[model samples]
Target: MRILLVGEYSRLHNSLKEGLEALQHEVTIIGTGDNFKKYPVDYCIFPKYFLQNRILILLNKILFRIFKLDLQLAEKGIRFWLFLPKLKNYDVVQLINSNAIETYPFFSKYLLKKLFNQNKKSFLLVCGEDTPIIDFMLKDQLKYSILTPYLNDSNLKSEYWFSLKYVQKNYRDLFNFISLNVSQLIVSDLDYKIPLPEKILIPNPVNTNKISFDNLVISEKIIIFIGINKSSYIKKGTHFFEKALAIIAQKYSDKIEIISVENIPYNEYINLYNKAHILLDQLYSYDQGYNALEAMAKGKVVFTGAETEFIDYYNLTEKVCINAIPDVDYLVRELSLLIENPEEIIAMGKRARLFIKKEHDYINIAQKYMDVWNRN
Candidate 1:
């Protein structure tokens, strides 16, 4: 079957493309390399450096307000319009999100109309914050959510206010348009799945072949790595992790080495943490996000979201992952325990790789997508 995956964020679609191709299915991915992360795609829509460069970006902004035209949007609109003729009669077309093209509502609706008409089947992934997800989160329904940090701190609101406002008003038409047209709504992680209970729950696809597992034997100081994207620090509960790390480092400065890398490129980010004994990932997430999953596949002991629902779903008795919550005291204690027993860290890392192999094997997850697409 021929599959056209629209947009790329979090490298989810890339992994899905790999899995689909491995099963002898034709697949193509169109994306902008997910902004700064620079994940690869078959067809690239990322703009030139002038549009992204600081000085030139300011000039583009000035031009945008004067002419009521955004150069980035203009480029994407033309490119996608020209590409539309080639997109028809696919077995399936999956959108990375409702606003996959990152265009205004009018254009988003136009693109959705064309996509729905062109493809045999259309599906939307509820991976990021969309109208429905935001609406659901506003209700405070979840036991704990990524919004917890933002809700508690007004200072953080400034960073996410534009996104919050968009979902509240500007995005409704496009959201409804896609929801009505798509064959199904699919969610890979519990964060999305919780708010969208009716959507199909498909495990995230991770290409295990791409990640290598090397068990490091620690006789001296154990290295713990944490990478922070400044924009997401508060939302991801990085402060909690940082506080815990501070305490842990102070107590076991001789036995533990804490490495924190900030806002690096995707490949470099992965390479930097490759030698670490433990990887500290997001704390407030309800599931292990793409980064944590990738690390786990590489046999790194990842401290990620292993909430109650996640543990119960897998029937996991052994701690395959260290569940890092939004509590500094809890984090400090867990890190301290692991530092004292280096052998247990090795054991947990081994289990982490096994859990990912069993639950998130790319081919198997891709088969699930095929099953759903074929059925619909």
Candidate 2:
């Protein structure tokens, strides 16, 4: 099958592409490299002129301030429009999200309509923030979510505008348009699956072959690593992790080594966390995101979303990763438990690697995707 995957999220599409290609299907991914993470894509629609030029960057800021217009998104739209000719005639086209290109809703809808008209089958992947996910959060369906921080403190509204914008009419229309165009809506993980229960639940794909697992050896100090993306600090409940780390650091200064970084590239981020025994991932997630899944594959015990829903679905008896929440005390306690009993960390790390191999192997996930796409 000739598959075209639109957009990238934490290398999810890239890994899927690898799996699909391994299974003898031709796959192409077009995306903007997901900002600073720089996930590879066959076609990169990043706004080089606006991003690289200092004058244009300043002008973009001014335009956004005065006219509430993001020139970067417009640039991305133009690039995608130019690439539309080569993007057609695919056996199946799957969007990474409703706002896959991260462009204005109206323009995104226009571009998506073209792809749908040209492609044989269209499908939508619910992996990231979109209208339905935002709507579900607004209804307070979950006990706690990424929006918990912003809901508790309205001052963080600015930080959450990227997600909150989906609730607007234009985005809602975009969602409706995509819904009508796509044959099926496939969710990536429990976070999206719980909100849209009827959608096909496909787990995120991780290339276990590329990620090697090493049995964690704790000699003197347990290294705890946390990478923060400042833009998503509030939305990801990173502040909770920060507070918890602070407490943990003060208590176990000699027993543990805390490594914290902000907004690094994906390669560097992975390499830096490779030595760590524990990786502090996002809070308020019901399932592990790509970063956490990759970390788990690397045999790093990650503090990410591993809720009961995830456990029950996986039918696990042992703890693979920590279920992070928006509570500093809870996070600190979880960290303390690991610190006090280093063997648990080693045990969990092994379980995490096995879990990824068992559930998230890229080849198996790609086959599941192929089955779904073919069935639809």
Q: Which model scores highest in lDDT?
A: 2
Model 1: which residue pairs collide?
none
Q: Which sections of candidate 2 miss by over 4 Å?
A: none
How many clashes show up in model 1?
A: 0
Q: Write the per-residue lDDT of candidate 2 for residues 1-376, one digit (tens) a residue.
A: 9999999978999999999999999999999998888989999999988899999999999999999998999999999999999997899999998889888998998898888999899999999899999999988768999888777788978888889999999999999999988889999999999999988999999999899989999999999999999988877888888989889989999999989999998999988999999999998889999999999999999999999999999999999999998888999999999999999999999999999999999999999999999998
Candidate 2: give the clashing pairs: none
TM-score of each: 0.94, 0.98
Query: Which stretches of model 1 miss by more than 4 angstroms?
Result: 53-55, 63-70
Model 1: which ten-residue window has the lowest total lDDT?
Answer: 161-170
The number of the candidate with the highest TM-score is 2
lDDT of each: 0.85, 0.92
Tell me how far the alpha carbon of residue 211 in candidate 1 is from the true structure, in angstroms, after superposition: 1.0
What TM-score should be assigned to candidate 2? 0.98
